[model samples]
Target chain A: MADVVKFDEHPSDTLRAGANFNLAGIDPASTPGYSGDKGAGESLLSELDGKLTQLQEQLFAESRTGGKKRVLLVLQAMDTAGKGGIVNHVMGQMNPQGVQFKAFKAPTPEEQSYDFLWRIEKEVPAAGMVGVFDRSHYEDVLIHRVHRWADAVELDRRYRAINEFEARQTAAGTKIIKVMLHISRDEQQQRLLARLEDPSKRWKYSGNDLKERAFWDDYMDAYQAAFERTSSEHAPWHVIPANKKWYARIAVQQLLLDALNGLALQWPVPEIDVDMERELVRRS
Target chain B: MADVVKFDEHPSDTLRAGANFNLAGIDPASTPGYSGDKGAGESLLSELDGKLTQLQEQLFAESRTGGKKRVLLVLQAMDTAGKGGIVNHVMGQMNPQGVQFKAFKAPTPEEQSYDFLWRIEKEVPAAGMVGVFDRSHYEDVLIHRVHRWADAVELDRRYRAINEFEARQTAAGTKIIKVMLHISRDEQQQRLLARLEDPSKRWKYSGNDLKERAFWDDYMDAYQAAFERTSSEHAPWHVIPANKKWYARIAVQQLLLDALNGLALQWPVPEIDVDMERELVRRS
Candidate 1:
């Protein structure tokens, strides 16, 4: 697998299940892909801008035609884990028209009435586009298991259901990149404190965040189990150590580039008579 | 009414009914408040970036506190009239977390089952947020009326329902800025041709675009009636001359700033003691 086509930051297959994919073993502060400072990351980001935009444009251009594949970057992270930052910095660099961002907050009454994957399925990216899910169906397993809302059997069933759901998306034309932005317990505390002190950031500080922090160990355990049950080659999870925000962002950008580059996308051909259309436009 | 506040480019009340507001009199090629080229407009946009970003952050921060108000910039335009451009260039300058952008397409089977405003009401920006509806409930009137999908009475009723809906939203702390991005017929032809010729843009073209062009006069008439019937003091529609895309973008940005300025919004105070929270976070 390592000998395959390169990603500047190839997602570690260590994240692949039944392998050594333990959440605890991975240090949150490590920068796995690049040894760049913020300035270097920003510069690299600038360089990738045109390529990323072009790739996205081609993908959108080809979509709705037959044999189109889309990318769904499913972002799962603990609260205050820079999910929004990635959306702003990395994904923001792309054409907003070509991308879809759905930040799934707590489900609504209407959403709760349906099964978990029902809402998730409705939001899958259309062919030839990039779809981003801030928190995804995995919330069902992670939070539900952490809170003991689901029994072991039901939990096992949901993991199976998630695997089946993702498999179907792949069978059709969706490449799923499930990224877990891994931050340590102490780092999260610093982030929470930062949010509390800054009036601008204070509103984002929810009382539930504090309560959620108390369950940190439980959440970690749930995440470990999730990897054990759900990670696969088809929908592989990349556990990106995210303590340095810049590294997490660059790693995610590389993941998207790898996915898009693998597609061998082409600029779509004109289905209409271009010369005639150009003449008409000239005449008008 | 004009004495209370200022907008760098205040929206024209010529769009208001029983006033000078008439669709045909306004030339689409005219730049209403701007006397600048694209370069100049881009510079102005850059200058406004920090202010807009700050205002949006304050708006979002002020929200969740009681008595907070929100802004909903309802954008209605003819196809290819630069709605997406305004979204990416103007509103995109703000915090994406604080702004909700919903491009309302054709209603689905489930959506058609309910009232036109049902799905709309679901996506209204929470307090302190700025919501952009690319094509809103107005579509039920614009496209529907142009095609005679609804009869005279039904059409009249939908307009009334829309006005009432705006009133309700205004009563509940949502300030509505309804804008019509008015582009000339020839401009549409040019834009459509550009899309057809450019491979990257080809995907955006549709056969229906030509079908729709055939009904241009009818759409113009439909829009005239829509303005006369529905533009209210509670929610005024700004008819922006959009053939000059730069002017349209700047004007929209100014309108948003005016809306935020009118609020006299302050940063929210903490419900709990800030000092205690800081101490607690320090301890943690």
Candidate 2:
């Protein structure tokens, strides 16, 4: 028999299984650094920026003619895993008028009383607008998993629910991009300790944070399980390794560009009468 | 006696004040267009960017050193003004690692019941971090002022309270910069009308926004009063012209650099021994 290539055995071939890259497995020496992909990433980013700007102008024009679409991005992660950093850098290139951001937190009585998605639903971007969430509904999985706020069966159900929820949003013309920032435990400790030492940062630290830190193993187990259950084809999680912040940021920018690349938009051309154009130029 | 250089009644002095170069009210004709100051702005921005990068690095170093300081910025503006654009563009220049952002909306019942600052306080940046607010507590003065949610006397009290509140935060090492993007009503209408035309942007348009638009004059009165009452030595408001978005963004960048200029921080000197230096050079 002819020799058969075992695709699953090779790391590169494993990528065909819908995992574009294994972020955690990358080694600094072997992997191309962020600046190394600077040419392609920068080109893509600049192009995407230009497209977005032109798209916004077109949307503005269309809104005058008829209405526009909204874009939503949800970022969820463990502590010190770079959610804030990713939002800052990835969206940095876009027009602010077309963007909005909200950071979700512990719910109040009102929010708790309503459906879990109610508070978040209010924050979804308006059409032609971009909305980013620092920590999103997946917190139900991460926090609820670790805190046992929901039972095992319930947690599993919630995971499936999130997928359906995101799919519905996508159907409603909201493009959903979800990212999972992955950081090692050592990095989180360094970050937490750093937060404690800085006077400006002292307010961010609490005695309870240390107590949570002690349960690191439990959180990791929960995260791994969540990953196994919730990652889906419609709204797959991009596990971004965040030890090298700059690289991680660039990776996120590239990921966003990749997702948005399919949305081809054309700028509305200002209707120009030939005579008026000549007269306008002559006047100038 | 030598001729008085500038008497209050002198027309030349008025002309000079109108011609003031550092962004005071320059005449429309002589007001260098947005592109006019691009060269200087870019050069200054590049230099400022370098300094900011260094400041952030030092801040991060101390973030781990023990007890760190944090910085926060609050932005409040009228509708059709350029708050979102400014946030997107100027904040883009910053180092993502140490920066965070939150956009405030109508408060929940819990937020309303507690002190107004509760929801906002939870969103403050931790030490070694920078936080930006899209619309902050000033909303109470601007929106509530026009809506009559607070009576005149209560509104008057809140204005004073805001200055004191921000001053307290400033003293606590939370460097505060407040900005108000000022756009002409005509320009605002132009933008708003455009939003209606574009399908992608249609979602941002609301019938109620037009109703609010009807109270433009009232909002302006409220804004003027708010500015007069709350502009403080510790936390002054920068009123930026938004007719020109590029100019507004550049001005904001300059303001940020000016606010941060006082923090003198240095990069950790390369850990060095004479023998190690010699060995490193020899190996190279």
How accurate locally is residue A257 in candidate 1, as Cα lDDT from 0 to 100?
87
**Residues A106-209 of candidate 1: C-alpha lDDT, one tens digit per residue:** 89999999998989999998887799998999999999999999999999999999999999999998988899999998999899889888877887777677
Candidate 1 segments whose C-alpha is farther than 4 A from its true place: A1-8, A11-18, A66-68, A106-119, A126-129, A278-284, B1-8, B12-18, B62-68, B106-129, B147-154
Top candidate when judged by lDDT against the true structure: 1
DockQ of each: 0.34, 0.10
Q: Give the interface RMSD of each candidate.
A: 3.0, 12.5
B51-165, model 1: which lDDT tens digit per residue?
Answer: 9888887887777676559999999888899998898788765656666778798999999999999999998988877889989999999899999899999998999999999
Predictions: Cα RMSD each: 5.1, 11.0
Give residue A38's error in model 1 in angstroms. 1.1
Task: Give candidate 1's error at residue B136 in angstroms.
Answer: 2.8
Give one digit per residue, the lDDT tens place, for model 2 in B176-205: 777767676667666676665664554455
lDDT of 2 by residue, A1-284 (tens): 22212112222122211433434464422213233443444454444456555554554344343445556777877776777666655665565545567778788899999877788788887766667888888778877888889898988788777778888887876667666666766677677666545544444544455556666777767766666665666665655556666556655655555455444544443343434433332332
Alpha carbon deviation, residue B98, candidate 2 (Å): 3.1
Model 2's CAPRI class?
incorrect
Q: So what's the TM-score on candidate 2?
A: 0.58
